[model samples]
Target: MNGADVIDIARDAVYTLLIVSGPTMAIGLGVGLLIALFQALTQIQEMTLTFVPKIIAIFLALVLFMPMMGAQMGDLMARLMDRVATGG
Candidate 1:
């Protein structure tokens, strides 16, 4: 493939990756930020306090968004396979 083709493929992969991972990441970030604010306000300096809630929130988000993630991944894979098939 040429530079344009490589760039297009990389762009698509990045797009698909972001689409697949964005929900869980956003959830984790939001939760973590809230927890940080709470900790700051409460002056609770417990190191492990921040992780559990963020992880749980991210897990829940992943579970909720699993179908969409799967579809995005599947579409990206199908596109790649088609490109390979057609020698794109």
Candidate 2:
């Protein structure tokens, strides 16, 4: 592939990664922030408190957004395959 084609593919890959991961990451961030706030307010500064809730929230986010993530990934893969097949 030419430099432009390579750059396009790299851009798409990064975009696809962000799209697939954004929801879970956002959930984790939100949950972590809330847990931190709760700890600050309640003085319950247990490390596990933050970890468990963030994990659960991220898991839930993944479950909820799995279909959209899958579709996005599949679309990206198809586009990549097309590019490969056509010699970019």
Candidate 3:
């Protein structure tokens, strides 16, 4: 592929990655910030307190967003395959 074609593919790949990761990351970030605030307020500075809820939320988010993420990845892969087929 030429430089412009490669740049296009790279841009699409990054966009796909962001789409797939956005939900889970947002969940994790929200949960972690909440937990941190709670810890600061309550003085319950246990490490597990910090990690457990955020992890759970992230996992839940992953479960909920899995189908959408998969579809995005599949679309990117199909586009890549098409580029390969046509010698982009």
Candidate 4:
């Protein structure tokens, strides 16, 4: 493939990655912010307090978003495969 083709493929890959991971990342961010707020209010500066809740929230997000993620990934894979098949 040419440089342009390589760049396009890379862009698509990154976009796909972001789309697939966005939900979990957003959930983690929201959870972290809430935990930080709680700590600020309670004056409890426990580092591990952030980890468990963030992990649980992210895990739940992942589970909830799994079907959407799978569809996005499958679409990307199909596109990539089609490009490869056509020697794009």
Residue 84 lDDT in candidate 3: 89
Candidate 1 residue spans exceeding 4 A from truth: none
Q: Please tell me which predicted candidate would have the highest TM-score against the true structure.
A: 2
Question: Each prediction's Cα lDDT score?
Answer: 0.92, 0.91, 0.89, 0.93
Worst 10 residues of 1 by lDDT: 54-63
Regions of model 2 farther than 4 Å from truth: none
1-88: candidate 1 lDDT, tens digit per residue:
9999999999999999898988888888899889999999999989999889988888889889999999999999999999999999
Error of model 3, residue 18, in angstroms: 0.6
* TM-scores, each model vs. reference: 0.94, 0.95, 0.94, 0.95
Candidate 3 residue pairs that clash = none
Most accurate candidate by lDDT? 4
Cα lDDT tens digits for candidate 2, 1-88: 7899999999999999999998899889888888899999999978788878887888889889999999999999999999989986
For model 3, state the Cα shift of residue 52 in Å. 1.1
Report residue 30 deviation for candidate 4 (angstroms).
0.6
